[model samples]
Target: MADKNIADKNIKVTIMPLGIEVKATRGEKLINVAYGQGLDVNALCGGKGTCGKCRARVVKGGISEYTENEKKLLSEEEMQQGYVLLCQQEATGDLTIELDGLNNGQKEFVPDKGAYAENITGNDPIVTKTFHQLTFPTVNDQISDLNRIIGDVPGKVALDLRLLSRVPVILRDGEYRVTSAIFNDTIIALEAGNTTSQLYGIAFDIGTTSVAGYLVDLHSCKVLKTAFAANKQRVHGADVISRINYTIENPNGLSEMKELVINTLDEIISKLLAGSGIPPEHIYIITLVGNTVMSHLLLGVNPLGIAFSPFVPVFAESITAAVDFLGLKTLLPAARFILLPNIAGYVGSDTVGVMLATKIYELSGNWLAVDIGTNGEVVLAAENRLLTCSTAAGPAFEGASISQGMRAEPGAIYKVAINDDVDIAVVGDQEPRGICGSGLVDAVSELVRLGVVRKNGRINSPKDCPMELPEKVRNRIKTRGNGLNTFVLVEGKNEVAITQKDISELQLAKGAIRAGVEILLDEAGIAELDGILLAGAFGSHLRPESLKGIGMLPDIDVTRIRPVGNAAGSGAIMALQSKEQLQIACDLPKRTEHIELSLHKKFQRQFVRGMSF
Candidate 1:
């Protein structure tokens, strides 16, 4: 049975039996309306009607009529039961209808429409501590305003314009009772009447390739919301060196890049604030953690020196900047921006963020933390010595370097496991769409195990393969324009293929990481590692077994491998929460020794040797 009502305003309409209800806009197509609400009535080509898994029943209103496409996807028995294609049917009126059992599968945790602002970690450095009061202006005690404030305020307490603007109002409102937000002894924001209830902070891990942020409540040191997006500045260049070169080639290019990242951050912050139902003024501080180039870019400093000779950063110390400098206008105009210390030109804030979050500085045992991104930052600790370096691993892992490659999005193949027989268990359990970074590692490893690919990463002949290659795999070679060695992972529609060129890209990426580790160990005079801590989203999802099989990682005790999720974000949060920790972060650059692996001739030899499958 079905019921219908024509509603004038946007309303929530509950579908009978399914118990699903969503607020939809006026005149929205019913099928489209359902899809928008995440009703997973399957559409094989995602509403393109190619495989047609979205058949449903319109038991009441449209029972007498049927569309032509509906008949093609439904059987006579199904039609009698009042079946229809969910995609083809339109919601002419607010209606209730029965749902099929097949479409009623259990739901997974889909991210909500709003931003998340809870359960965050690593956000203490940027938030300010409050412990100061304002004085009233009296006619008899006519001490000049500047001198009166300066005399009472502690040493090195700097005040920015945003805080200066609100001083008079705050003084009058609080009647001299105020708690000032202090960053590194500098006044950032002032709260009247000893108000200290709602202190909020935002921690940002601005990578060269991507941006991840966490909104935190400073009072509880809890991360309230988290957001991640591709770095918009990447459209200009892929690597740090490339970006630096762009900056050097075009004088304003650096400023433009900085502006793009700031704008992107501002947008994300706005969305995050909206999601958390918090106002921008409530956020008292922002802590930014990124690579050296990224840190320099955020500060609008020229990174040309880093791109070229000597490779020196303008400053490696942690800096507390006014939010206005970065165009974060919504924050307490005087909101503080605390930047993490950088070890070197290449090893930037990201490494420091990892160090802070992992507590590598406090640990006594030999440890290695590898933050894998386009620029693979590695930190190795042994006894009293700490060494760090940046390896130019490029963007292969994120699927940027390869042709026809993409991120681990909805249809992307995120995993592949093949036995000796060469059978592939693809991710998403459907026709292969495109290969992701993790899937590439698995595919290469499985190809080696099945002898489909040779030890040197060459594609074997059809006869040499343990099992016959699929039409998809064979087509890669057949369709190659220059008679190059290419292998397709999927065929025809939504096809995914890998060419020799793609393999080379992966090879180069792996080589850089492997060489970096080896060089770091060689310099440390350490033969082996007790353990390897892999950090970052990419590193966390990477299968160690697959990585070892493909020779990306040394074949060691697998038990020693650990993935620490979002180490940079974790570190940023840690810095935001502790003033002591913030002080330690400020001194880390001075204490660290940055080793340039590219300058070493031995690094080239090691990288070449690591190219083997």
Candidate 2:
């Protein structure tokens, strides 16, 4: 441990754009300080200083000299501009820094609507409210307030001691008329007057990169509002393994991760309540679904075990607890929190949510569902069997790890079409800042189709281009400073191009996903798929033709491919609206079979074959 005198000294750091000031101990890593203060600093390599995504400019500061990683990753111009890697620098004195890239107030594109199965029926929510008009206690009939309120309620009614203490006051406040909020057999809350119509619940799909929330009316089973926000835990890393490593390396990492996600959920809840004009107390239940690691981190459980061989999680079953200690400021004191079950260490409740939303188990024909993200989860339902697997596709699809790649936000190139010349469509119709997942796929698909990029994932040199290729398109292929060929999509001051390295990254990502799909199909004895369902925000926005063109997905009729918008989130909403759906979600883990790709001998062979376009 460090000396007490040295540890006592403090340094001040002010972050720009947000103008947030924070205090840190002297000699602390700048990235740790920023993340501890709830700032979203991008650390794709988990502070190993390899990815160079956490670049920050120091307006004025006394800091440690850069490490070898920083020297290698930062350009001379950037170093001259006083830009330093937050992961590599330690604060020695007061500092003022400015963040860059997506965290710098970029507008993210979040899917607000999802496709819900038509078979889901009923409004029997897990939490319901019933108004009670009790008779006034007299000398002839002197009954206790708690007993009188739950006298006619069926089953073994249980109430918290704290809530039981307020029984008399609540009963007398409305002249013996009150509303009881029942969660199963427990009376979770009691209001002075009739609040039967105010019953509400919130469902959340907590992902590695983003969090999506839905507010639903329990009485009518209609979604009143939906909101989305970046998962604040992204400041630590982009993938589950990076986050798991953080938890292992840091003493308080698990709690910090839990707090960051809870804060994200609170922000989404605030937005949902504000948009719908709903009271916080009206939301009596909160249902959440996420991957196994995310679920472990949210509950302050150590997720290090989930990142290794013979992977084991602390708990794989559903959990129900009160939200009082969850740090959700916008929720009621009596609100209950429910976490859906996980199918495996990698195949989490999000996949279970996908299964629930698509009703894949009931489908008679062979169907494949893929939720694409940093980690791709594939599910196949066929021949009265359900199988799932996870592939580490990396953040290439989300636009990290690739040169000049970014999220699907404003100024991001999202669509590309190449004919005689390149035709690109950017998000927000603004100047292209960088390429996102869809645009990356589309661009590479077009290049492969046009013979600019070969099946082996190599970009053809300008002199070796096809004779029939247009001059404008051929001229766009140029060598960059790294001596590698790049295909320029937008030419200007902020030139957006796809380098040979970018193509390789895309190939690795798409290849892993394709390999997972193939393995699942083979395991289930599926000869052909009747339909393919793309789930999640990234998956939904991806064009079917481009996905197939790049060989990421199987070659099938385009009409059979469907985009199921945020299906995981839709399943969470289904659980929030109906108790039966919640039961189904909890039971899904048992029925589904998980295939561990790491132990599979055929994975490597399939992966190598899938890498080719």
TM-scores for every predicted model: 0.74, 0.93
> Among these predicted structures, which one has the highest lDDT?
2
Question: Tens-digit lDDT track for model 2 on 182-264?
Answer: 89788998989888889888989999888988888878778777788888887777889989988888888889899999999
Number of colliding residue pairs in each model: 21, 0
Name the regions of candidate 1 deviating beyond 4 angstroms: 1-161, 420-432, 466-485
Model 1 over residues 89-131: C-alpha lDDT tens digits? 6565455555544344323212111122234344444555554
Best by TM-score: 2
